[model samples]
Target: MLVKGQCTICGPELENGLPSTSRFRRLAQDNTLVDGPSLTGYYTSCPAMDREGTTVFWRDGQLLAVDADLASHELFAMDDGQNVMGRTLLLGDGRVVVSLDSEVLAFHSSLSPLAEGPWPCGDANLRGNPVMS
Candidate 1:
């Protein structure tokens, strides 16, 4: 059970790091967290159901990647070798490619984007190797 607490007042930090006034205590029962002290931190608008959303999807709910960027965060995209999300990327040749479970597209720095695609349902389909065949 999760209990939300009200921040009666955020205690001031000590000269070092400790709080000056300790007014709250961790509420637990059987070593389980029943309640916790109200915390003061920055928060962004997040979807309760977004914990399992795509890797680098846009705010509009379009999936551009099949993985998540829990590590590297780009301004508008996240890449996971086999999939990407956030914005439709581009190639110097100006061809718009697409990806699907049955089809996966990739680009080589030396090769043009339209050169080849749908190569084969190899890795991402077999052992879920998003990085290679």
Candidate 2:
């Protein structure tokens, strides 16, 4: 079940619920959280990045993602990341080291995400009709 153009180096597959080896092992042996207190509503105030308000929402098992600052809603997953020239870098990458402006935080793979997914604007352009104007 391989797809074309999937990132080999980045290795993000959460958009599809698939994960690399370590992730698979964690799921198999680790505690599976269910029932009891659930995520009825959760909020976190990430480092602010000017201009306007910033907030994003996503569910544990849900696939769709929504960010408040965006003009229109996007289905891509992730939150509180920067938009580079054109590409987006998820804040939870093991490869990337996060810094807090004046203070530089520790650099370690311990911050790595359990799973990765397609890039921010990751979905392929598959919508619509063939009308040449």
Candidate 3:
């Protein structure tokens, strides 16, 4: 599974049902990481994945798209100086929906939609799932 931290995104190799520290793939990193609030008005971090498995996340006020194998690229930059405070939505129509500190915006994504599934957009219950429990 993919994991997102304050300064790095990684996919860890599971060994005996546990993540192996030395075998994790470091997908991306941002030294100037910025914290963002969540829908509940608390600072949290989460990333969304499209149907095509391309991961999308916010870092340093920029929207990034990363593939499964460590290929990452910046998709968009938020110039309004607002933090993305919620989980991104990968709609069925190829649109990316994000909630910022002041407003909600939708951008056309080149990636495919999340369509329909138990874990569409990697959010099983339509919540960000910030806490593992």
lDDT of 3 by residue, 42-75 (tens): 2222556664556665545666676655566667
**Residue 73, model 2: Cα distance from true site in angstroms:** 32
Which candidate ranks first by lDDT, i.e. highest? 3
Candidate 2's TM-score reads 0.18
* Alpha carbon deviation, residue 47, candidate 1 (Å): 19
Overall local distance difference test of candidate 3:
0.50
Instruction: Tell me the lDDT of candidate 1.
Output: 0.23
Candidate 3, superposed: residue stretches over 4 Å from native: 1-45, 115-117, 120-133
Model 1 ranges with Cα > 4 A deviation: 1-60, 63-97, 100-124, 129-133
TM-score for every candidate vs. truth?
0.16, 0.18, 0.55
| Worst 10-residue lDDT window, candidate 3 | 35-44
Please give the lDDT score at residue 97 for candidate 1. Answer: 29
- Per-candidate local distance difference test: 0.23, 0.22, 0.50
TM-score winner:
3
TM-score of model number 1: 0.16
